[model samples]
Target chain A: MIPVIEVKDVVTHYGSRKILNHVNVDIQPGEIMVVMGGSGSGKSTLLRHLIGLERVSAGSIRLLDQDIGHMSHHELTRFYRKLGVAFQGGALFSSMTVGENIMLPLREHTNLDEKTMAIMVRMKLEVVNLAGFEHLMPSELSGGMLKRAAFARAVIMDPALLFCDEPSAGLDPVVSSSLDELILQLRDALNMTIVVVTHELDSAFRIADRITVLDKGEVLTIGSVDQVRASTHTRIQDLLNRRFEETILDPDEYLARLTGESI
Target chain B: MEHSVHVQPNGHIVSFSGEIDLENSPAARTRLLEVVEYATTVFVDLTAVTYMDSSGIASLVEAYQRAKKTNVAFVLISTSPAVLRVLQMARLDKVFTIHETLEHAQHAKH
Candidate 1:
């Protein structure tokens, strides 16, 4: 199938350091495509390349059959309207009430009158389960509520492509799972193509239709969670099994046996 | 009144026998903390507990820490199998001693 977004042999660099090398992937519509990696593994860098936040150093990134790499500034501005980004921190304005934050995008992008905009704001808040708290300032909300409000703002325009950076971070597991369900609900409700950049293993396994794992600027594997878990690739095995160095450490008495040292 | 603290001369028993959820966890926590103040051995009876979530677990962990600070030995008893399973899943059983009945728990040495 022709993908909604396709990157072909894309090589992106920061100054002289190459970050994304020969990266190629395809994202389909109405699926949650997760980009996962360890820290400094270029997950965010790849997102930047995909969203046109950074220009490609080589190759092409095609979005909706248009070449995003080669677009002019004016064209890129028009193209971005179809995409939505909920930053890792929710990135809400501290000065604005929840209603204003959700209303900003609609106000800037549409010519709707005050009455219509107000209704739309309420609708978006309801989508995120924050309907009645629209008048509350950002500081008055809990961590989970803030993330949901930011999510409400992201979808205010009913974007075709929704991008979330670590949507589950800082939330407890139960709350995180609920947030995952909300993301899935939004995807089905709007029929939107979703791309999530996260390193959370449990969340990734729960919500992803397909996952693309990156390590040291290279593609590791791209498949369903079961396929990735069953893969025998050394890197994949180490990651899936969580074979961190700390977990392998023997008790101090056992360690002393190997070192021939007294405890 | 809220949940009661049975203050015997030997130990303090704070028994909870209902749903403990996020909205009411604060009250539960306060009740348990108050019980720890009266006795060196504090027993929490949860055999009647039907359901508990992460917030309830967190409140218990907090109470455990507070009891430790006061040199009180905190123990949990009579957790329903369902609630016991959740505590075991979260690996809190290793940190807490689980008992089949409040009497068995109160009699066991801390």
Candidate 2:
């Protein structure tokens, strides 16, 4: 299988706190790889690093034959134009219409005329089941529509890589399920590679071609859905069962944090 | 939700009270676009607005686009944390000139 993204010995940190320790991943072309972890598991940080948003202290990240980790700011900016990101918060420009927001990438990266831009924007929206609503603002959309709009904007440029951060977060179960279906359809219809960072177990199970489970900045396992489900790793089982281990805290550190002396 | 649009000497002041949301945003967008066509300046006063969602944000964005197209100065006056947080998430704080009060927004020469 051809790899679209490769993370090799990727080490990252937040100040002195190690976020990702020697983590590696290979996402195949046209595959939907879901990265799942509990809060503070560094899934989000990894997404940031993968997308060239955050600089990593160590390791090499190659996306589509180019080393994103070592790319210059100028080069990164140009490279980023070929990518699409849908943040958890929808990240749509509140000042632009849905049509305008969806067309933003096309306008920025391509010299398509106004008519062509409008046509492409409408087409993408239609794919997301948001047709005839382009005049509506992001605010007018329901949570489901908002997510769909984000997806539309993300795919407007026909990017080779699409990164979605918590696409189903804060949405209702039915809406979220529909979003999962849309994600699958998007993969099939557009033939784009997607990297989704999420904690929603149901969403992960529904859309992922493969699941990459992370725990405390480390990869617990990366395998097919059935393999992940049948894995005997205590951490993986705990994550799947929603069970949290008792964190034995040291008295000194506990007292320090309680009294604000830790800082 | 109650929305009103007025033309001040310095610019246009569009005010909203109660919820600026899905039910009211269409009307609000209509009102703002009306003023944005001829007014060289626009200031949306959202001080009394208790709640705002995506629809409300879209209204403001439409007004901003109108302002830009017609070369009108557009600013948003918001002191409510709820409203401000949403703007921050959408990163519209960088796009719209935001102030704490209508007075500051009106006097903002920049």
Candidate 3:
């Protein structure tokens, strides 16, 4: 079967600094692929690239068999209807009610009747465990509630591919665990190919069909949870054990920075 | 998706095949509601339905509500596993009147 998402030798840079170095990953249909890394490891950048947010400096990112890099503006807009992205900060519009936030995608993409759109919003809220919170404003909800509402909006249209950035971040263990279960249930029910970018090990292990470990803008390993847990790679072990790596700076570069002079 | 409506002695049976998704769910909703307006009983056959998204399920929900309000019977007959999983996800399997076959739906009273 054709993979739903294919990231091939993708390279990205912010100004002169390289953020993603020849990254490659393939996500199959109905599979949850977790992309996990430390801060500045390019996991978030990769998520942005996959969702067509950031332009890759080299190689290509294909979503649902279409090369996003080559697509025109109009084409990309149409293509986005098939994908969903739940941002890290629960990017609900404060002005709109939760129900309206969820319905926004349908309103923009399709000509389905108003009643159908309303029911779809309710059903999505029900799926996300925010059934009766639809009438409430974003400010009225707790952090976890906001995240669930974000998820409801992301999935209101039943997207074929769902990308979640830090889904379980900043929530307590209980709420985070519930969000993990919700991701699993979404994949099972909707047959969605999901790419979840998270630094939370427990959440990654709980929902990932396969884990893609990244370090320094490169893929360290991509394997099942057991394989990842058993690997003896230093960086991977450090990540799994929550050990921070000490940054070693070159003597000349350090002197150059301290003296404000070129080496 | 392709659909056919058969008027039986008891009710109108609407059989849908292929995918019921955002593109065509509006049509399904319109057809189901129109049939429910006149028929005493409506049976939605999903045995051949390959896929159904939230919109399609919403169509079913709307029709079911209309049926309830009109005092007409709304029954789902022979649901595919794909469709059933989605229904079960929302815990809607318990909400709709479902049966394994037309014979069972005919014999059972809603």
Best by TM-score: 3
- Give the DockQ (2 decimals) of all models: 0.01, 0.02, 0.70
- In model 2 chain B, the worst 10-residue window by lDDT is B83-92
What would the DockQ be for model 3?
0.70
Docking class of 1: incorrect
Using DockQ as the measure, what is the rank order of every candidate, best first?
3, 2, 1
What's each prediction's TM-score? Answer: 0.65, 0.65, 0.94
Q: What is the lDDT of residue A68 in candidate 1?
A: 91
Clashes of 3: 0
Candidate 2 chain A — worst ten consecutive residues by lDDT sum? A243-252
After the best TM-score superposition of candidate 3, give how far the Cα of residue A151 lies from its true spot, in angstroms. Answer: 0.6
Candidate 3 regions with alpha-carbon error over 4 angstroms: A243-263
Candidate 1 Cα outliers beyond 4 Å, as residue runs? A243-263, B1-110
lDDT of 1 by residue, B1-102 (tens): 136678776688788777775446557866776777767988887877776543456567777878899889998886476566546543567888778887
Q: Distance (Å) between predicted and true CA of A12, model 1? A: 1.6
Which order, best to worst by TM-score?
3, 2, 1
Model 1 C-alpha lDDT per residue in residues A1-263, reported as the tens digit of each score: 77988978888778889888898889998889999888878899888888889888888989888999889999998788778888888889999999999888857755544544565566567667887989999999988999999898887766779999999887766778988988887776556799999988888888999999988888998999889888899987777667344335467854664455968
Among the numbered candidates, top DockQ falls to 3
